[model samples]
Target: MRIDASVITPYPTFAYSVLDRYIDGDIIIDKSSALIGTSSGIYAVMGDETNDDFAPMLMHEFKRREMLNQRFTLFSSSERWDRRINELLGAKLQRMPRYSFTFNEHRFMQSQRAGIPDGFRLNRTNKESLEVNREFDAAYIRKYWGSVERFADKGFGFFVTEHDVFAGECVSIFSSEQYAEIDIVTNPLFRGKGVAQCVAEAFILECLERQITPRWDCGLHNTASIRLAQKLHFAAPETYSLYVRK
Candidate 1:
């Protein structure tokens, strides 16, 4: 069943990426309930929690199709939905804390800036640059956007390179009309340096120009990511539960 995209409220940016057709994904609707699944194995459940039989039926279908695996994480839209998922998954579910941040323009502009190292150059992701970095390579983009061509058309990223070596990259892992979720990776050799910030700043600059809200999400244990986000002036950390298969 197909449901109106407007009905699936309070979803993560990735789910919106799916719902808005910015990326390829699976959508299943049953009466007032809906499930949106992305290629990266993240799923969002929204609407009527009283539909007790919906989730189990979908689980059965997933198992039959061999798609019920340990790699998937589930996001529930509300507390009632959370309880429903817990009841359905039982001991197989492990809840983890995820932190979400809002971008603050004034703080970002006020934050200390990091200049690209003398030999380093920041470039937007293109056919040539995508082939240079494994972290933001064709495979990674395909995993999120379904195809390199689609990503090239709708998505944008920035990567830093020193001579010919890839230093770090920041890309929109998922996006919709109004939001772009950030995913960053700094090479081990460039970890202590500001390559991440520089590349990420370029990505943010483009987002601001495009009128898209850049979003940052990280797990509680990823202290480094949290610190970097704070340094980039992404404020108001709100914690949410992410249910993983155990």
Candidate 2:
């Protein structure tokens, strides 16, 4: 059964991206007892834990779909949901801490500018770039946004290039009416040259121009990601537990 997205609380922006039809996903509701919003192997679970029938049904569905073998992740909405998932999945679940950061416009404006390195060019992502950029991988956009055409139409990003080679890119992995979640990748050869910051700054500027809030999220152990977010003036880290299949 399809459930109202409004009833699901404390959801990640990706879930809303699915619910709002900005991206393709599944909304699985168990007779109004529980709901699961899923897209691109990421799942958000919420609703009545006291319902005895829901957990077993969810477990069965997971096994039937071979979700564990496919490397799926589940986000818990509360401590109760955490306990419920633990009870159902047991040793199959590996708990990990994830961090989210809120953007600070003032700090971002005050931060030192990210200058493109000599001989490199920063450009907005377009259909042609999406087709030609191999280092950044068009597969990622397809995986998250369902197609290059959709992303090129509704999403935006910035990529760095040197002599026509892809150096780095920062893109909206998920976007809704009001939010754009950032994802970045830099060619290992170009790392430590501020390539990431350059593209990220461009992406953020585009988001701001559109009045959409930019979001940053990463695993707790991803020090590099945390550092970049902080450098970009994304403040106030809120930590949460992310559950993945073992």
Candidate 3:
């Protein structure tokens, strides 16, 4: 049976913890688990792998709910369900390789931070600045960060500006008590000038100061992101699989 996001809020997975805040009723909670769907597709599933009915129940409800599409990505936090999902879906889907990396505070402290270029200023994202920078994509910001007010309270972000114009941003795409996933973008005019790196460094420092580890996850093929993560001192990447609609 479907229940509230709050009902599954204590599932003990980083994915679920992050989803809890923005689900806003776009989820299904059974006795022991929950499935969250987004406009893009099934975003994540959280439950006990040991439960015999867990996988089946998830599959059943996912079909019954008529989620956005038949083909989409699903995040799995447990290995038990990974095999079960693969066996059930088989070649009807494609397995995509991705990387998950996290910061080691000790190692990060020993690394060198990138320097921001001259004439650029870094600032924390706030309601006032966000309004002034009308160029920032409103829909994209809302979809990833939720309301700007909530972001200010629960997450952290930094943006680099050049002569009072927006240049780039490094923001927490998903955050739980223990970790904050980093997301960054650079304006075309500012690309190749290291603006992204500087902003990302600011975001990382904030996370470290607050004792929250920074996380970096990206597709294996995303070379640019991989380079940035390595440069920022993220630990070696670990491989994981997810499904993409065929």
TM-scores for every predicted model: 0.89, 0.88, 0.77
User: For residues 14-78, could you state the per-residue lDDT of candidate 2 as single tens digits?
Assistant: 88788788898877667546545555778777777767877777787567556446647788777
Off by over 4 Å in 3: 1-42, 46-52, 64-72, 78-80, 90-93, 131-136
**What's the lDDT for residue 100 in model 3?**
83
Candidate 3: RMSD to truth: 4.5
Query: If ranked by TM-score, best first, what sequence of candidates would result?
Result: 1, 2, 3
Error of 3 at 241 (Å): 1.6
* Per-residue lDDT over 1-246 for candidate 1, one digit per residue giving the tens place of the 0 to 100 score: 565555644468888888789988888788878888887777888878788658776576445334644357788677787778777775767888788888998888787778676789988898777776768888988887998998888899988888768899888998888788889999998888889889888888888899888899999889999998988899898877788766
Any runs in candidate 1 off by more than 4 Å, and if so which? 1-10, 61-71, 110-112
Put down candidate 3 lDDT per residue, 59-174, tens digits, no spaces. 67556544544445677655665776677665555677788886677776787777788889888877676666534444555665556766667776888999888898877766
Candidate 2 has which clashing residue pairs, if any?
A: none
Best by TM-score: 1
Q: What is the C-alpha local distance difference test score of candidate 1?
A: 0.81
RMSD to native for every prediction?
A: 2.5, 2.6, 4.5
Model 1 worst lDDT run, 10 consecutive residues:
61-70
Question: Which model is ahead, 2 or 3, in terms of TM-score?
Answer: 2
